[model samples]
Target: MADLWTGMVWPVAITVVQILLIVVPLLVAVAYVTYAERKVIGFMQLRQGPMTVGPYGLLQPLADGLKLFVKETVVPSGANRFVFILAPCVTFILALIGWAVIPFGEGMVLADINVGVLYLFAISSLGVYGIIMAGWASNSRYAFLGALRSSAQMVSYEIAIGLIILSVLISAGSLNLSDIVRAQKTVWFFIPHFPMFMIFLASILAETNRHPFDLPEDEATLVTGYNVEYSSMAFALFFLGEYANMILMSGITSVLFLGGWLPPFDIFPFTLIPGPIWFILKICLVLFVFFWARATLPRYRYDQLMRLGWKVFLPASLLWVVLTAGFMVTFDLLPHH
Candidate 1:
């Protein structure tokens, strides 16, 4: 019994520690991402952002988090209490779990699953359920309408996203994320698949419901969208989940297109930095684009959003997959294993 207990307990303990290591930093990053967004946008707009709190607003997220933590959670009178509560949990958990298979550096992953890409895709696809649940449980027509739009938008764009990933898979010849990164040792996939890289970036923006694709949260129509009834931590979960998803998507974009942790050059100064550091820097660059797009672009009309997904990205992605396969076969570039 002692041996059995020891065997089971040790692995579980180590696993829990690993998960905490990943999650704690991630939560902190999510908090600061908000600050960075504000600061970046503020700079872009020629305004000082968050200058008061704790030395150049370094502690602003902490303060905001404390405020939300103490605030009362106001559930709608008619809301289904259990599901309404469950919805944000679903979104937030799904967002965090997607990071399990993400490779920060060579051999530096939690799960290291064979089908990491598929795992990420499935986890991301389930995100809509949370919004739908919140919408229905709130017993509000506006929330429901927002949910409907979100579901439709996510589903439409996901097809294009899937097709784009197919092109990546075909080129890398592996679904394991580390293998995908290693496959790009010579040249990043972005060079060969520039078109798909661009499309993938756009698709992720739509996938995360970011600006220019945030019709579900459109103030003009939905008035704050599905989680409008939520307050405090419940709302914070949704907010945190959004920012977390953006970071996760940025990580994915890094892995798929920008060569994960590989340095721009293998020689001299580039090789001195660690792989994980390189990975983080890439994620930050992609994240900056997310903020930049929000500050610069106007939101798309709902119809335009749908049309871009179906008519533009979908067909283009499909065509690219075919083209990529042809080029691979012609050049004997198809990866073995």
Candidate 2:
């Protein structure tokens, strides 16, 4: 028993602690992200955002979180209890675990796996499952319709997203994210793959079901979509999961495009900032754009959204992948380091 406890329990406990370290701060970041969004959107609309709770409404998210935590979860009479309750849990879990592969700085990741990018991609792709499950389990027409729309949207954008990632992979010549970043030590992929970067950013927006392409959750249409029937902590989980996924995608965009943790320049002032700080600042920038789009862009009509992904982005991304490969092969730009 002692030997087993030392060998098995200790390792498991250590892993759990490491995961908590990553997850706890992420949850806090999600809270602040909501505050930031509200403030940004408010500024854009010429209004003051939440300014009541804790200075400048700093405590709004905390108050909101506490309210949701105390609120009783009410499952619809027609809902599938097991899956309905499980959906948000799964969504939140998947969102948190993606950070395992994310390196904040040198030797800073929880799991420095070789296939980090693939891991992130796979985890992100699975996010739609929770939404689908929630919709189907809710047993409501609105929920089901929303799920169907979300499924189509995610799949359409995913194809383009995959192709865009492939272009980066081709340039980096490695599936590992650290290698991908190191390859960008001199120049970021966004500079070289500008078109692909734009497409990728757009794809992630649709992928996260954010504003503009947020057809599933259109209040006028699907009646708030997959989590329509969810309330209290259940709804809170879905809410946190969405914001968490946004941050995760932002982190990914940072790695694949902006050069994760690498300063803009190697010179004095820029290089003086720590890599992790640089990494976080990049994420904040991307997230600001994420919120900015929500403030400025109107929702896309369903047909237009689908057409943009499949008709325009799909073909364009495919062609870009080909062009990228040809350029790299012709010019020998492959990462030899």
Q: Which candidate comes out best when scored by lDDT?
A: 1
User: Where does model 1 exceed 4 Å of error?
Assistant: none
- Superposed Cα deviation of residue 55, candidate 2 (Å): 0.9
TM-score of 1: 0.99
When summed lDDT is taken over every stretch of 10 residues in candidate 1, the lowest stretch is 328-337
Model 2: per-residue lDDT, tens digit, 227-277? 899999999999999999999999999999999999999999998899999
Candidate with best TM-score: 1
